[model samples]
Target: MKKKLGAYLTNRKIMATALLALTLALSACGNSGEKANEGSADKETRDITIKIGYQKYGTINILKADGALDKRLSEERNIKIEWIEFPGGPQLLEALNVGSLDLGHTGEAPPIFAQAAGAPLVYLAHEPASPQSEGIIVPKGSPIKSVADLKGKTVVLNKGSNVHYLLVKQLEKAGVDYKDIEVKFLPPADARAAFEKGSVDAWVIWDPFLAAAQTATGGTILVDGTDVVSNHEFYLATRAFAEKYPDIVDILLEEADKIDVWSKDHPQELAEKLSPQLGIDVESLLLAAGRRNYGVQPIDEELIKAQQAIADTFFNLELIPKKLDINDAILK
Candidate 1:
């Protein structure tokens, strides 16, 4: 009876050990499943749609319509391209600041205002100044022959834009006090309407609006940005995005460079392509395309200094809320 009891005790110990081992094995399998799910979740986070913001007035639209960027980026990395349209640079930068846009392009002044507004931004590349692309224009047969003629006259412009600086510099150059001009702040569409109806004596605008306005209203250029502001177009990304996904930044720059070259080489084709997409006349699109400098360049010290000057100009005029370091916005 003692031997049988001892044997029973040994069997009981063996059963307990087997049960413990089975429980551990089941837990291990569960852990492996969880880990596999976690890995998949991480990959989903990494491979996401890249959101790009662009305005209607530039070559970015041309690139978008071409579908090259979509094919190249999507096929190469299995990523998706999402394009967001903005009315103007200021609006685009606003979206960028709010985390809605990861990448965008804007004029020199928009980035300055964006940085002053405490937006985390980095300048990725620049389009050389296309001075002729923007102009302070007057209606046909209007008496406003010169920038000085704009004094005491209601002049309409898009506030906080590249042309804003142009208006300021042109006024200063003409010895017309900026305070003397009855400035009407409006977007391109409204300003164009005002210009045509003779409600506004002058309209300061950029391309294709400049081209469209001139074509539609027979307006003449009073003064363009030839010797004044660079009117440099800037490609920007969130500082966080730039730091986190530098490889993507390189891809963007590469694609942009290719588009720039293509646009320059095929102005007529570009105009034809953009005409229907933008709903503007082909002639106007051609004129707008011809004047623009579609060349993409890396930021240099000279460009940085030029940008800083714009920042200082706006701050001194109390246009922007405060002064900001342009260098802070440049990617290292």
Candidate 2:
């Protein structure tokens, strides 16, 4: 009876051990399945951060201000986007080129300059013709009347910006030597202050700042981009980022087109939305937005030729160190 009891005890211990092993094995398998699901979900969702560089102007801001873009992307791409804004084109492009931002918007000259600076940047899309967006302005009663009038006057503008070439071109077009003008290099804000204090004679800049200064200082637009140049804002990115997220690039371009079209039809509404953010008067913003041509005019051979003209001028004048090929920098 004792032997039988001992044998029974041994069998019971073996059964207990087997049950414990089975439970542990099942638990391990279950955990593995969960890890696989987690990995799959990560890939399905926005695993990689998509950084967008935006400005305070136009419909792009309006769409972004409403949080609709993220919602739009979430429904389609299942990714979360991060917006990193800049004060100007140069700064924004700088971030995009340095791998800080996946993509950004900037005027035509920046991508050229970025490529020249050996930044791994390329143009992905172009903006509509914003003729009155950037220009040279003077006080309401200032003596400066034209680009020629700035021959010996203090004119302020941001350096290495699209407006920089505009100033040069305006002078050249008017038969005024670039050096004939006392160019005071300042950002838009500081320049606005100078213009208000009657310190600077003329301010060469972009809207809605141009429009704001006009109303604030009781200033007048001496000349807009029409005379100097028609701006072509670009969507640019690093070559690697572009390839990695081609789908996102396409989406951005399409969304941009939609935004531009809507903005064109509703100028006043768009301006009101942009006013507080831009720190400009609603009336001025409305006027500027109305004047702006909002659309996506792709950069073709003709556009390239125009851009090449400005680039060639800059090269000849040694504004940029080396001559650049506009073709090598453009993507579709």
Candidate 3:
């Protein structure tokens, strides 16, 4: 009876130990599974950040000041925006090239130059040609009355800028060879300083700089982009970013369109709002705002042809190292 009891107790101990070990193994698996699920959830809810490059003026600036983009993206998509200011489109596109910027706005010529340099850029949308928004100007009292007068004279402009096409076309139309005029490549601020000091005979510039220059220095317009280039303001994104987050791009465009509509209807109000930010007086801001064409349009075949023309002109002039197909950089 003692042996039987002892054997029975030994059996009970073995069974209890086995059950405990099995329970511990099952519990360990359950904890591991829970941890795996938690990691996946964290990935699904990861936050994204978009870095935007913008100039001191234009729709992007207005968008930044408006706060609509920030609010909507933050609340809806858990996305954050970082705005970076560039001196000019060329600089902005350079930032886009090195992966520093996800999106940026520029005039028509910058993208052509950027694409030629192998920047992976995609055109998203464009503001209509505001012909009067850009021009070739001289000091108020200068005798350089027309574009024809620019022959053999010093002209300052931002190189590879939207106004570059304007200068070329304007010179061509006026029967002056591009090489006949002395061209000084400078950003707007430096170009403005040169213009004010009479160091350059003429300055080709775009507004609100154009407007500000006229007001500040009493410069006279030799020729605006009226019958020349379209002077379209383009919104561009890195090809990778556009492809990966198209929905974010769409939201940005939608918000920009809303601002454009409001800007068109409320020029005075827009000027007043931008005055302090731009540090320009309301009068000049109003002047710049007045002539601006305020609508974002999709890229079309006609627009592509226009852009291609600019590219071809640059290639022919040997401004770019190689010929570029504008369509390749365009977003499909």
Candidate 4:
């Protein structure tokens, strides 16, 4: 009877140990499945595309050509990228308003116009001012020497553009009354034609158009925006995109910053790369790229105030349809 009891106790001990081992094994399987499912869920969440609007020039073009953003966003971040080209910022912002594009870069004036038009957009980042990038140009060796000479002259420029502000500020500084000048609103191509034909006294323009005109037509710079207007370029995103994917915005801005560094470091290489892409000569490309300051910056109070001043200027001049509070458009 003692032997039987000892054997029974040993059997019970073995059975208990076996049950604990089985429980642990099953628990491990359950945890493994949970982890696998969690990973799958993360992948499912990230199966989305970011659409970007770009012009034929600038940092975005360089980035697109390099395929850096495409590789980083698609392969590493698990987000697809779509590139949509627009003729200019105004058209790009129109796409943003209609939900066609998630993000874009543009001149300072576009967002103000977009805001006034009631587009839901936010300023994401900015390129440092490149005042020398845009300017008023005259035919090479023309007698019209100074900004004061522009008074009572028919000057052609894109209406409501960043350069428009430059022209206004420069005119004021030169003691040229705004009403004294006959301003013709022309797109860059037409403006270039008019400028070359002497139909207009001067053409207000920006690079690589500025570079091209100077090279192609021997256009001379009368005055640039230096110490006048900042001519800062802004990166803008639709309100919906920014709110939904702040991380993605960060990623894009970081990429832009990288390109900024790259462009500054490799100006000659950049000119070489962009020459074919922009259909402009390498020398002209170098000139345009060299003058531009390519750093990206976050939105801040001082920048907002500067933008507010622009908004006010346009509003007072009745350029925009309504009074716009620039603060309302800035992303928090």
Clashes of each: 0, 0, 0, 0
State candidate 3's TM-score. 0.87
The reply for model 1, stretches above 4 Å from the true place, is 1-46
**How well is each residue in 209-282 modelled by candidate 1, as lDDT tens digits?**
99998888888999899988778998899998877666566667667778888999998988888888788999
**Residue 266, candidate 2: how far off, in angstroms?**
1.5
Residue 38 of model 3, lDDT score:
46
Q: Which 10-residue window of candidate 4 scores lowest in summed lDDT?
A: 1-10
Best by lDDT: 3
| Candidate 2 lDDT tens digits, 42-66 | 2333545688887767545665765
lDDT of each: 0.81, 0.73, 0.87, 0.81
Residue-level lDDT for 1 in candidate 4? 27
In model 4, where do residues sit more than 4 Å from their true spots? 1-45
Worst 10 residues of 2 by lDDT: 1-10
State the weakest 10-residue window (summed lDDT) of model 3. 37-46
